[model samples]
Target: MLDIAKLAGKIPGISHHFQQEMTASSQRLELAKTILQQAQNQQEALIERYQTWRDRLIFSAAMPVEPLDTRITIVPPPHRHSVFATDGSQIAPSHHEIAYCYLINVGRVMLHYGQNLHPLLDSLPEVYYRPEDLYVSRQWGIRTEEWLGYRRSVLEAQCLADMACGWVNPPGAHHEPNLAMVDGSLVYWFLDGLAHDARDLILVPIQEAWEQLKAARIPLMGYLSASRSVEGVNFLRLHNCTFDTPNCIMNCVDVEEQQIPCKVIEPLRDTTLWGENLQPGQRGPLWQSSARILELYDEAQRIYFCYVNVGTEIARIEVPGWVAEDQDLFNQGLGIMLAQVNKGFGYPVALAESHNQAVIRGGDRIRFFALLEQQMIRAGLQNVGTSYKEARKRGSIA
Candidate 1:
């Protein structure tokens, strides 16, 4: 004992290091507990349940679980300082007799401040839904062909991504996008791509690009512009705030009235994300959704409603507007065989769905246009033609 004591006295640094270790251990334990609790608070059990089903069942609906959603309007950046905007579009999709062109417009805005770059909206692709060659589906049920339609949508969206990236840094450009804020999530944000082919999911390329961005420490973000899409029709799976009605009712934990603060972040560092409720997708851990809304104006006028079979999972289904013979809202009692068309580098969600699932059996363009005219009148707008025409440049107005 005497010899041990004498030896210990000689090693003063070891004693100090031991004391520091004990202190660190105590502090780390507390931190670990708090972190675990916070994670639990945000844990999504519904997502887990869905995952479990995916693993256990062989005959499940295998519905695409696109966790990312477009539930709100993107609040455009306040300034555009030398930013490069990017967009995408589908040239055309075959349908009935008329040609349907789908456009996805991308805009990227970058500002250089010293060595650091400030991105306004980097590769923010907004969908300008339209048609290429479409025919009425009332002759046949579109529901049966939903999977094929959805697959096409996924591919089209990916094409849009490619188009958007084409502008990120031109072949010989010296500069990179200061920030990249896409209109949709990293990729296939609205696509349940895994349902079709996991490797083919648009997420593959999107993920690769995103990783490159992260490694380069380039700030990249995505904005969910609208609350209703093919996948978003079913909004019950979300763990965060959701609006049953796309208008004035915001279903948030704290704020319950109107307006969901909005943010289109290029996550250089932690920041805010606000908009409508987002749907789910393949990018789980890396992608995050922050609570932010732009303003509380004009929410009462918007409404989104879609129907799906709650009992079973299924591949994505799209009831293209051109395929439906529903009464056109632009005119009354007239059948609307209308299809949205857009310029190259535009959005073609062409996967447009109606809220009420209006029957198109006896629908016509004249009556359908009439209803659309009424809707336009109620909204105090003269014509969507001008708006749509103006959108031809931006690729979208939604």
Candidate 2:
């Protein structure tokens, strides 16, 4: 390999790109402080303007408002409640390996807080190797690993929904509250990038999960830690800018050129903005997402989110519009999340446990390969060889 030490030594020698950016960093922080102070000064007017936009703005409208409401207090979760979470892990397809197959494993945990703190857990793995699964049409021209990832997302949601629906007692037998949660945003982040044909394959399963959860009224949610989304800041900009046009170039013409726009907010991420204000167990106001992907969702299933102080960090919790619009369910869901965080010490215990179950260790991969190779030999196939590059890496001692 080329000398990494020499490359590291060269990093500090670069000044042209680093110096001006460092200066800009300081300037941005100062601007953010100013924006925060201004937000405090004009809170009422800003909320008013945000409401006006919320009522009139269409899906085609630009920079929709995402208002922040800090006027709230934490409530205790129900004395007897159950929480469920699911997470998935996958071993990507390896061309260098024996079989042209990939494995998707899903882990699920259901925790009951009442009646002696009972817990249930499970893990399931599926492998795919059919010709149709191994290869897609020539138009897409992608690898099997990419397609497997799409399948994996759908499987994770299905696992959670399956666990939720398994609770047959309902209101009569259980005599307790129930909530289901996942580890990320409800919206499929990759959906917007997929072709219509590929998108349909992934969307059907996730939508089926949503339908099952809704029918059961289990109050499903998605929790994201350290989110870098800036939807909240975009809302603040809508309030700041005077331009009525959806495609305003004022920021580009003024801010980039160092001309100082009439009003600027330093482009704060939602997590950062809410981080400053939310106290432990407190949650910010619910904000409807302006993501174009939401248009594909049914009216009741549109996603909304809020930032909550989970003690360790400000995490964004997303829910369907049905959950958001229902006052009782919304409060109870937040209560359940806070309780989960409290029990787990800043994170949800169910999520943590499920992730631990889903993780595939290095040893596990080795064991899997050994089993596959043995099977291949028994089936009268030979020459199971790794790529030359992988072979070198495995044999490298230094």
Task: List the candidates' TM-scores in order.
Answer: 0.27, 0.84
Q: What is the lDDT of residue 24 in candidate 1?
A: 64
TM-score, model 2 to reference: 0.84
lDDT by residue (tens digit), candidate 2, 1-398: 79998898787758766897677756765666566566656666755565565544332212222344454667988788988889989898877776778899899898887669658888889888888877873357655777788888889989889887887335667647778899888877777867778777888778888889878778889999888787766555544555454234433453443443423545446677677778887788777786787777788888888888888999998999888877777888889988988888888888999999898999988898889888888888868767787678778677
Model 2: worst 10 consecutive residues (lDDT sum): 57-66
- Listing every candidate in turn, what is its Cα RMSD in Å to the true structure after a full C-alpha superposition? 25.9, 4.1
lDDT of each: 0.29, 0.75
Residue 135 lDDT in model 2?
83
Model 2 ranges off by over 4 Å: 1-67, 137-139, 168-171, 244-246, 249-263, 385-389
Candidate 2 lDDT score relative to the true structure? 0.75
TM-score of 1: 0.27
